[model samples]
Target: MKLMVSFSRKKVSEPIIARAVMDTGVLINVERARIEPTEGDVLIDVPDESARTVCMKMRELGATVSVLRDAIIRDEDECVDCGACISVCPQEAFSFDSDWKLSLDQPRCVLCGRCIQACPHGALSLQK
Candidate 1:
């Protein structure tokens, strides 16, 4: 329940403030200020106790486990501007470009995954 979400940059003297939460979901917007997860970051989905164990293991391995989730977000980018996604989202998580293409507001998103289903373009997933 107390998993941390850290931003790790190799060259930076200090990583930015990390986010730790006890939530069930996260945002999937790849636009501005998005904390995109990479391959080496640890993902946990078990109970809170198990998550603690995993966090300890991650720390032992010199990796920081910043947040815990029951799922990993794999978002799709096949947006063709049909505008179906923007309409269904209660949070207005998606927006449009000048060309009418779709862009995401990652910080404003809560990763509800509704955009994935609402998409006629199949532009969202929970894979990575």
Candidate 2:
């Protein structure tokens, strides 16, 4: 499961994520992180089995967590595989497979909307 975790500037310096990882035994992969002096937002992936515990722990530490399952949807028919999304994706979520077919690593997506905006064919969209 993927999650978008928000933290206030006051909480940004906390070792909340480390504690959650240690407590829940969940492998947390940070997809994207934007932490400023005033606020922070992080996109992370957690194992399904440990999502509940991790989220609970995050909330207890005063972070806001939102599940991001299937956050980005791609329309194959509309996509020409032009690779527009590839260059702009900070998380490297878009890629070309062995066959040069455009592929998306959904879990790595931060729902940043860059892919959607870069797609000339309007092939990508946020799931809501």
| C-alpha local distance difference test of each model | 0.49, 0.86
Query: Which pairs, if any, clash in model 2?
Result: none
lDDT of 1 by residue, 32-118 (tens): 233444322222233555656545544544455565343324344565667777877776867788988767665445455677787
lDDT of 2 by residue, 1-128 (tens): 88889999675457767877887778898878887778888888888888898889899888999998779999889998889899999889889999889999887777788888989999999986
Give candidate 2 misplaced runs (Cα > 4 Å): 10-13, 75-83, 86-105
Best by TM-score: 2
